[model samples]
Target: MPSASTRPVAIKIDDATRDRVKRLAEARHRTPHWLMRQAIEEYVDREEKREAFRQDTLKAWNEYQETGLHGTADEVEAWLASWGTDDESPAPEWHK
Candidate 1:
């Protein structure tokens, strides 16, 4: 969703860490820098999910206050846990 910017980055990592990253890159048929970028992208995605969930929870509480009803985090978790569909069953042993 944003324009891409490219620039060279330099860092000094411990020998062991550098070696491990090089080996991982070889195994994946990519350069160590590419693997590093991939790791950074995954980290950013996880952080975004955590922040969004927190904001959503706060919004839900505000709506609840307007309705003069309140629900605890545990209560919401329990309600979500109870929701399931019979047709969405796990695969049978034979399928495995």
Candidate 2:
């Protein structure tokens, strides 16, 4: 029996895609249902992260516009260039 968190979903795919999914599932020693579930999970995870990033960017943009506070392009570039090094600098102070 499936858990409460699991629900049956019906999706329609073309013949070629359905065959591909079946072949891939067989190659991985998994059922077609498992493969589809894994694919949906992976896709949802990626899209959720992207959506979060987009929302954060929009929030930051709105805040910047409201405060007219931002770092110069050169400062931002230098900070980015220092990434992954001991010399990595902190974010520059926001300015008008």
| Top-scoring candidate (TM-score) | 2
- Evaluate all candidate structures by whole-model CA lDDT and list the values in order: 0.76, 0.91
Give the range where candidate 2 is weakest over 10 consecutive residues by summed lDDT. Answer: 1-10
- Listed in order, each prediction's TM-score against the native is 0.58, 0.83
lDDT of 1 by residue, 15-85 (tens): 99999999999999999999988887788989999999999999977876677565556665656665685
lDDT of 2 by residue, 64-93 (tens): 989999999999999999999999999888
Summed over model 1, clashes come to: 0
After superposition, the stretches of candidate 1 with alpha carbons farther than 4 Å from their true spots are 65-67, 70-96
Pull out the clashing pairs in model 2: none
RMSD, one per candidate, in order: 10.3, 2.8
Instruction: Report lDDT (Cα) of residue 15, candidate 2.
Output: 98
lDDT of 2 at 86: 94
Q: Using lDDT as the measure, which candidate wins?
A: 2
